[model samples]
Target: MKQKIAVLGPGSWGTALAQVLVENGHETILWGKNPAQVKEINEQHTNHHYLPDLILPTELKATISLEEAIKDADALLFVIPTKAIREVAHQVAAIVENQPYIIHASKGLEQISHKRISEVLAEEIPEDKRKEIIVLSGPSHAEEVAVHDITTITAASPELDAATYVQELFMNEYFRIYTNDDVIGVELGAALKNIIALGAGAMVGLGFGDNAKAAIMTRGLAEISRLGVALGANPLTFIGLSGVGDLIVTCTSVHSRNWRTGQLLGQGKKLEEILNNMGMIVEGVSTTKAALELSKQLGVEMPITEAIHSVLYEGKDIKIAAKDIMLRDGRIENEFS
Candidate 1:
């Protein structure tokens, strides 16, 4: 079952996924806007800027032209940042002729509309040109996946066939795929956990112990589930790989850009300075704004999200934000009550 797959965006995640596809014996083309990076991947079999010190598979191809990547491809996998999704999808929609399975691994809600990535994709890509959209998400990191470290993730779609197809498409000895029907839950869990990761990193930056981290993570899950359920997601899905699993990895791992960004903020660095230096997308920063807006509209009380939003956007001191969360009116542990 060798298929032609186009992986859009040549960042660490996209390159790692493209390598997996090539190893799986598929024709994988990685597309990037930067000609220099595309040339480096095509000629050197390495993406040094994103996955430094890791050489990509020799079979993995890179391209600068979107039309070249999409032409005759059986599937398109998008791994770009949230902000770029609609623009990229629009371009893809204009070029793609044959029906292909549309898949996305990027995590975050649309900042203004609070739309899920799949929702945004569906809006842009006509149904005639693609099958049901599948979302690949879980606790895996690009750096670890690049080195063949054992990783498991979920491919979720309302159409079971699409999910199962993606499951078989990416599964290998080191990378495992599970299928779930709860796309809403899966996407939300993937996006919202980055917010908690920021809080986790901030806790470390503030010199707090494990107790603080544990408290935030525990309560963070509560609010995440609360908001997710309010938005029509299955409550049980929150305990699965995309929910609790993603939360654990992103919040605790040093490889998480959101966590690192929060750590810098905790260390008293300004957001603009940290973002300018990081050279990667800190999705949690934008997700925080979207989550805050959702919580307000839905009347969901998400203290951790609100606190992080204050610190990141409102210029509130991290310590004071932490104090504010701690001093909120005590309620029962169950947020659904």
Candidate 2:
């Protein structure tokens, strides 16, 4: 059955998902803060800055007003940045009269509190105004998904029905959704992979061959799962799409802002300079800080995350950090076994 869905955060990811919703014959309203961009989406059906080469669906409407976007929506999909999730949820709580199914596609951790996106939403939004939160994540990129490239992702929720409901809402010939209950593993996998991607990009920047990059990705997965399992996530989820799959794509793809940031850093560029030029958020940079802090608190060793954190925030030389990561004491490969 068709329903009204409000997609918040009119960035590339949000806009791409809105295009899919429009194709699915749903009443999709995309909300953003920029009046000019909203006007362009409503009028020209194009978001030149984010998805420059793709034309948006004419049937998909957009607005700058938050109340107008969610007043009558059946579901609310959030694709905003991690830092903005709490603030936006608070704004939604203030005006929303009806309870809408909440779904999020953002991939990062809260910096100071070290909370996941769902935790942030649950804390900010009153229970009466929202249903169980669902997180959608995997290897899918907005640029590829916008042009009908085949993509598979996991829709995870503690409630089985909620995950299934989200699966049905997003599934299509080009887009496949699988339901998983390992919300913790899925969310951590998505956020933590960005840290590895940054390291992978640094490897490339240092002119390392494929072997070095593969080692970074492999070891990166080990530590990510270590910290994740310590926090009560399913160990097996690390091998799934959200884990190894996301790590590979984000690390290798030119589309990943995190990898690109690392690449520039490896080339001896400054963080401030790279961020100013990218025009998009590098999630791994922020996630590295959060992951490093969380790892220390949890007593889990995350060498790559620590290295990236040092390179990004602690003024450590990128090459020296990479060398330090390699020269660290070796351990049994199959610690999980």
**Model 1 C-alpha lDDT per residue in residues 1-337, reported as the tens digit of each score:** 9999999999989988888899899999999999999999989888998999888888888888999999999999999999999999999999899999999999999979999999999999999988889999999989999899999999999999999999989999999999999999999999999999999999999999899989988899998999999999998999999999999999998999988988888999899999999998989999999999999999998889999998988889999999888898878765352
Please give, for residues 220-328, the per-residue lDDT of candidate 2 as tens digits.
Answer: 9999899999999998999999999899889999899998888889999999999999998888889999999999998998888888898889999998998898788
Clashes of each: 0, 0
Per-model CA lDDT versus the true structure? 0.93, 0.92
> Which pairs clash (backbone N, Cα, C closer than 3 Å) in model 1?
none
Poorly placed runs, candidate 2 (over 4 Å): none
Per-prediction TM-score to the true structure, in the order listed = 0.99, 0.99
Judged by whole-model lDDT over C-alpha atoms, candidate 1 comes out at 0.93
> What's the true lDDT of residue 301 in model 1?
85
